[model samples]
Target: MGAGPVYGQEVVLTAEVDLAEIVRSKYDFDVAGHYSRPGIFQLTVDESPRSVVARKA
Candidate 1:
């Protein structure tokens, strides 16, 4: 997980997951054994500003 403040916008939180790890954990499968393409995920959060901000000192 990663976070950063966006000046005038809401804070951003980023989470990344590896598809190969998911398959290996869920079904005991190895992506390396089969032909698979690499994958990456990026998600964004845009909601209440108050909830995302931290009080300034």
Candidate 2:
């Protein structure tokens, strides 16, 4: 599960379980635990939102 164009400096993807790792490894993003969600991970790339969105899965 994922959504957003959070309008920040990084491309942030909210993915759960195996999906999180897949996104991170596939895209070379860094994976971190979501602040408020269990079993969910945040994959982040330090880049413009528009640029990252273009690389969507």
Candidate 3:
């Protein structure tokens, strides 16, 4: 939890794999991975890659 304020992200993706690239380049994680299954994923990023793509979107 937060002592005062905190920002968090939780991603459950079924498609839109393009967003996955943005996330892969942005956040630094200690330990992370995926299942062999194709579309199932858990992902997020803190660097706000959306800002990089916002103008295009």
Candidate 4:
């Protein structure tokens, strides 16, 4: 992946899972299918010059 610092605007992360067997199987909880579960991903972003505001003392 190319690091386009000057060109990059924003970054986002998304996750999803398959709910086929998980819906029918009785595996305690709904977790029968092996897929990418929706989870929270933290990403550090550098704000643009226009978006960043300087605090005046």
Candidate 5:
């Protein structure tokens, strides 16, 4: 086996939610994997209270 190099990338996302609903609710996100030419790492999502962060690492 051989080692590989790594590339860096940054992404940002946002969404709105209804704060008048139940204290807590389960919400689903329709996210899928990516298929493309090899380069570095893979795509990922970083979720937060006010926004979401995505990146291709």
Candidate 6:
């Protein structure tokens, strides 16, 4: 079989907040399913300003 897909570089960050917990607590949302499957969530610096203001308000 041919190669399944081409892969690009990857970057990982260790942030202070637990992203999954924040999403569940703030929005009542869950990225991982009932079995706790792994998933990806993307947050960019562009959202930082708006997020900060939202938290303050």
Report the lDDT of model 2 for residue 38. Answer: 47
Badly placed stretches (over 4 Å) of model 6 are: 1-15, 27-57
Report the lDDT tens digits of candidate 5 across residue range 2-52.
Answer: 233434744344446667543443233223322343354467776756636
Q: For model 6, what is the alpha-carbon lDDT of residue 11?
A: 50
Question: Local distance difference test, per candidate?
Answer: 0.60, 0.58, 0.50, 0.53, 0.46, 0.51
lDDT of 5 at 2: 29
Error of 4 at 21 (Å): 4.8
Ranked by lDDT, top first: 1, 2, 4, 6, 3, 5
The digit string of per-residue lDDT tens for model 6 on 5-46 reads 445855553446556876578555544544344344555465
Each prediction's TM-score versus the true structure: 0.26, 0.18, 0.16, 0.20, 0.20, 0.17
The 10 consecutive residues of candidate 4 with the worst lDDT sum are: 32-41
lDDT of 2 by residue, 1-57 (tens): 557767847875775577677766855543343444545754577675564355547
Ten-residue stretch with the least lDDT total in model 5: 25-34
Kindly give the stretch of ten consecutive residues in candidate 6 with the minimal lDDT sum: 33-42
Clashing pairs in 4: none
Candidate 6 lDDT (Cα, 0 to 1)? 0.51
Question: How well is each residue in 1-57 modelled by candidate 1, as lDDT tens digits?
Answer: 445655876765687877798667866645554435335433458775575567888
Ranking by TM-score: 1, 5, 4, 2, 6, 3
lDDT tens digits, residue span 1-57, model 4: 334345456765454656785766666544534432445333468776564577879
Model 5 RMSD, rounded to 1 decimal: 19.8
